[model samples]
Target: MFEQSKKYFSYILNPMELLRTKKVLQVNPTVASPRAEPEEIKIFVFDYNAAQADVRELKTVPECFAFLDSPKTTWLNVDGLRKVDVEKICAHYGIHYLITEDILSIGQRPKMDEIDGLVFCLLNMMYFNEKDSAVEIEQISIVLGKNFVISFQEDAAKDVFNPLRDRLKISGSKVRQNGADYLFYSLIDMIVDNYFVVMEKLGEKIEGLEEDIVRNANTRTLAKINMLRKEMIVLKRSIAPVRELVNGILRSDSDLIEERTEKYFKDVYDHILQANELAENYRDMMMNLNDLYLSNVNLKMNEVMKVMAVVTCLLAPATVIGGIFGMNFENMKWLHTNTTFIIAAFAMIGIPLIMIRIFRKRGWF
Candidate 1:
């Protein structure tokens, strides 16, 4: 046992052996796969008021700007930031260069800033991708001005703002009755509400892992636990900043956020707080799951050791007896008689049986 422990320490202390055996790297690379293609830009314009609404798809920047001067609240939704000259649109709205830069950058953290009567906010939109069985994150940049709101997204294929558009189609919708600020609040509210969907999927995954840890803990399960832990970290990183952003908006003195709309912002803030708390809770649960998985692995190792030790114990006496009788001694009592050989055979058999019985009574095997 001492020699075995010495060899274990030697293996551990050797730098080359440690380097070869340990998994020392963990990374999630951001490069796109070879099969992926660049996405095209899609523009959606919504012009609405309490009395009337118009929705259309625009192909050019000039067409998008046509509704900008209208008295009604106009919302321009731009999806897929690539290949489009965002500077021209920003120039048309008097948007600052820094704000335009933030809009084009795909991975900016959530933040809110007000400049010269314009309110700019950056947010992370998260959802579970069924095809990949992973959480997908997209950046959403919103600019709220005097009579228009422009939203920029990295993907042209999907968004959560469809419900608000559906509501706008109805006559006398609250979103239509209010100004651009209310529309801004509704967009933010929809984004915040979608967080719950992502959280629910995460919760389900955690529960499934818990069951797996209890039923069978193996290398695959361990890898899954680590994956989930990393995902939870990502989720927390995505949410914590948004919570701060919403809090900043709620406390800001910007005139772009009206007094009546401040209450709606507060509601959005509360939702973010709830989502943040849920993320923290899930993180704690993942830590516990990791601990549980390690404990199960150790327990399995202990069981294997017990079985091996029992086998060794059962064979020990028989080996000793056989070794003793096999020695050469001409004058020995067992050397001259066939009975002696028979007695030795019985002794070997009897000793092992006795030991096995004793071990059984002690519940050692």
Candidate 2:
């Protein structure tokens, strides 16, 4: 009994060495912000009006329900998704279950969905971490209501909407004076602007990969290129949806959106188009790099084969002579004599050297 207890203790201490303990340990999920837990959701309401934009934090879903009908354009910024209370909030605001499902699911493609009296837009905002050589993407969902804009994010961390916040804070910023449409455009414009920053970093990575391939196009370069290609693919997936979404928004007659704000959205729409085009170009360039590396490898292999062929050609005569003399040539007594052996050996040596010179002259070496 004591021995069995000791064995179990040892197994617990060193599970890797124990039998039936082959399952891999699960890694913890990455926490994007301090407020990553589901219980704490921070909701900020900013109502844009002719006088001053009133900004306040809502403590309950009831507060949001009460504040949606004000004459000012209200912006509801919800900063976490784990709160079970969000369902009540969504219900109160008339946001459908499908849209709420999209809010909870992070992997949804960047897209826009609209129903009667609401336009739903999902945008992926990414930040590049150079030290880690990775990018972190967060979902930003915009609910454009009649007199309000509701923005939902996965985690309550730093977001690109701060620029719009600053604009609202200042007296002359476009966000302060414009309707919900301009605020919508400003949020999207901010997102698109940040994308360029990420792309510039991506451009730098592509440049580095180019240099790496030229210097030493090894397996590592191939892997790097594959990684970049995947990232570009994701970028394309994210950007392409917005292209159609923005176009739809532009074409639709949403009474919630003011006519003055169309140009701002068009500006963002053009940027999205440019981003999609750039991603395609990068995809092609990375492919070219892959082809370039393959070509280099083939050339190297050909050089190696050429060297081996030249060496074989030089040694062929020597090999044949040695083989003929090695067997018992008893018919000729001179074959066994020292003088004949020396003569045959010299001929073997001379023949190979002549072959070597011929090959060199022909530039085969």
The C-alpha TM-scores of every prediction are: 0.85, 0.81
Residue-pair clashes per candidate, as listed? 0, 0
In the range 88-150, model 2's lDDT, one tens digit per residue, is 777888989988877766456677778867888887888777864555578788888877888
* Error at 247, model 1, angstroms: 0.6
What is candidate 2's TM-score against the reference?
0.81
Q: Candidate 1, which ten residues in sequence have the lowest lDDT sum?
A: 20-29
Which pairs clash inside model 1? none
Q: Residue by residue across 85-181, what tens digits does model 1's lDDT show?
A: 5777888888998898777764566899987778899988888866544566787999999889999886756688878989989987799889999
Model 2 pairs whose backbones collide: none
RMSD each, Å: 6.5, 8.8
Top TM-score prediction, candidate number: 1
Off by more than 4 A, model 1: 1-40
